[model samples]
Target: MNDPRSPAQDPDSGSGLADWTAGAADWIARADRIAAISRPATEILLARLDPQPGQRILDVASGAGDPAFSIAERVGSAGSVLATDGVAEMVTALEGRARERGLTNVQAQVVSAESLAFTPGRFDGASCRFGAMFFDDAARTFGAMATAVRSGGRLAALVWSCDDRNPYFTVVTAALDAVGADPVEVARTVFELDDPEEVLAACRGGGWVDARVEAVGFPWRLPDTRPETLIDTQSELSRKLRKRMEGLSADQIERARGIVAERVGQLEAAIQDGDDLIMPAECLALSGRAP
Candidate 1:
């Protein structure tokens, strides 16, 4: 997937390592929120992968180890899982989780999808959950992923579909607009590389065979959400949006928060006990076999 914007113009252009590392580290602290956003989708991905014992699997951009650790459980002691991220912090968090779960078959490492430091044809299968979309050189990343897996091995990834297809993100967009923040830039970053053609192009570029795309949808609920957490999450979104929507005012930020809070309130009421907020999300699950 070639970038419409040149590397010189993109944060991922020359060196996205530092920024990506820091971002993942900071975000790892919000493990619960991360899980809320991705767990259901991850479950669907694992079910699709249908990992078997005695097979080796690699999880690229394993973020906090949700997909990686889950894979480990399925493979059991006979199978092994290498869960890697480009950020050390993410690997650390993943390691911690693996320890907690006594998952000896799972190991975490710091590695990138574009330049994985593994021997060729070492893995039986590889998977990435909402990870490959951030690559500066997506084609190179896919090629490397292809090289890592043995012939006939599987390549699977879970990525967000277009913005309109996802209400969780649309709600965020609405809040940002209410706050008078320019959201085009952040929105672009969020969905720019998510097009189906680009994804298939990358996979084909990497020499993957039988590439197929699946659409998965499920309800994601945030239970026990605190007002403070809601405000904080909105603020975080506002900050990210600020990178694209310049000149965001405090008043606008407050307004955005109020609107999002109201939406959450309605969702909470729908929970029957005013304890949770649920929204629907759609994702693309792309898979292929390495040649």
Candidate 2:
């Protein structure tokens, strides 16, 4: 998992605290959209975790609260979910969302995955959605998660499978490349653990038993949206993309948008239904039980 990009250029380098903190506002603004796009993966993780009613759960790196909120509903008022993120701003946003939804069972905290401060065996289950890949040390984070969950407690995580299987990433990278943008360096980190074995190893190293990996494929659908909207949302959500875009001229930005639109139209897995767009996405779900 050695990042090829220099620390100065890597958005995910170190703890990625700064990058995530800075992007909190944007993520909060697009929370609903992000949740919609990642709903399938969330569902898969939730199923794997199999959280039971009256059981406490831990959700790590819960940036606008996805499965956290969903888990709260599943656990009901009698149970609870501790949703955490390294960035305080993200926790604030998560708290606001929880309050807005009247999810009294959900609690938001600024806690990093690598340094979870919860007592040992405090939770019945733990889940991390699209967060394992960004962890500075996946095994360490998993180890912390293991410590938080009771023995035999379930643990599940979702991560991008590969660049090839996920057109949502490739299309954007292709468009950026077509416009002479250096997206390759920034985007490659997304698939650092593309191999299922890598996830299994991390789980085992962190004291998780019966670790297993599964490939989950689903359509990332956006109803009443166009390719341009997707590109715009990506630019705003991706810190590196936004920084790169800052240097581009107005004409170059427009060109990149057009390229993205064209590429989206040509994707084999992309389906156009009325004004809606569906792009194929694949992720690896790693599951195990605390030892």
Candidate 3:
């Protein structure tokens, strides 16, 4: 789930919208890769939301639509999920993903979490993953999500815990920074929303009752991945860094890729789960109920 806030409206040049819009196809291609990492968090969020069959749900900032698709399976034929994101390109990709699976119960819409066009109290529950942190106005955007939930409905979100605990981003980011990347852009993502206190505050500000934040460790495994494959995945996954690195000569890019792979590969080898390369990661799962 995401803030639904469009990057074009974001004041910061590093807001991630331009690159995301320009390279949505890459994000779609790597959607399964992201799903591999986020699957665990989605389960945690689903448990928090507790959606039953016949319930109506919302997933904000549903980039590429994993948690949404997973939720659709949980809700089954009787239930429905409205997946949304302000990025039209993301929304389009989500639609295709849903169609590919023949998931008629889930629909993708281009909308912002800061301003929902849905009817009041229309949703039984709502969930977001890896989206809340990028919101232009988190309080208002999260609040808008809560507003869409019916009375006594639940809201759950997944966010990064701390950069130190997430080598998937930290190691590569550190390596990239060493090569003259913009610290502001590199530091802006997972690190920005790493604080649980901020997550709690956003829930409270969003007008949710009995809000709480908890830290959870997630295992990310890239199965049978080669160094080159890992580097390509990292390049596409790191939106900002990939955008900046595009201007580099092919040799420079390859060298930078090697540096990142070397750093991230160390993480890949740290813990191998079966033949898969496992990268240890952690996140904060925040949940609350609309009053």
Of the two candidates 1 and 3, the one with more favorable TM-score, higher being better, is: 3
Tens-digit lDDT track of model 1 for 1-291: 221211222334344454555366457776656776567987888876778988899888887888788888888899999987777677778888789889999977777665575788999998988876677776788788888899999988888888766656666567766666664422124464568887888878878899987777776666655442454544453446445335766676667667766775665332322665556667888889989
| TM agreement with the true structure for every prediction | 0.80, 0.89, 0.84
Poorly placed runs, candidate 2 (over 4 Å):
1-14, 182-188, 227-229
What tens digits encode model 2's per-residue C-alpha lDDT throughout 28-90?
Answer: 888988898778887898899998889999999898899799999888989999998877777
Candidates' RMSD to native: 5.6, 5.1, 3.9
- Candidate 3 stretches with Cα past 4 Å from truth are 1-19, 179-188, 226-232, 244-269
Better of 1 and 3 by lDDT: 3
Best by TM-score: 2
**Per-residue lDDT of model 3, residues 17-103, tens digit only:** 443455566778789878876777888888898889988899988989989999898889999999988678788889888999999
| lDDT scores in order | 0.71, 0.81, 0.77
Q: Flag the better candidate by TM-score, 1 or 2.
A: 2
Point out the worst 10-residue segment of candidate 2 by lDDT.
Answer: 1-10
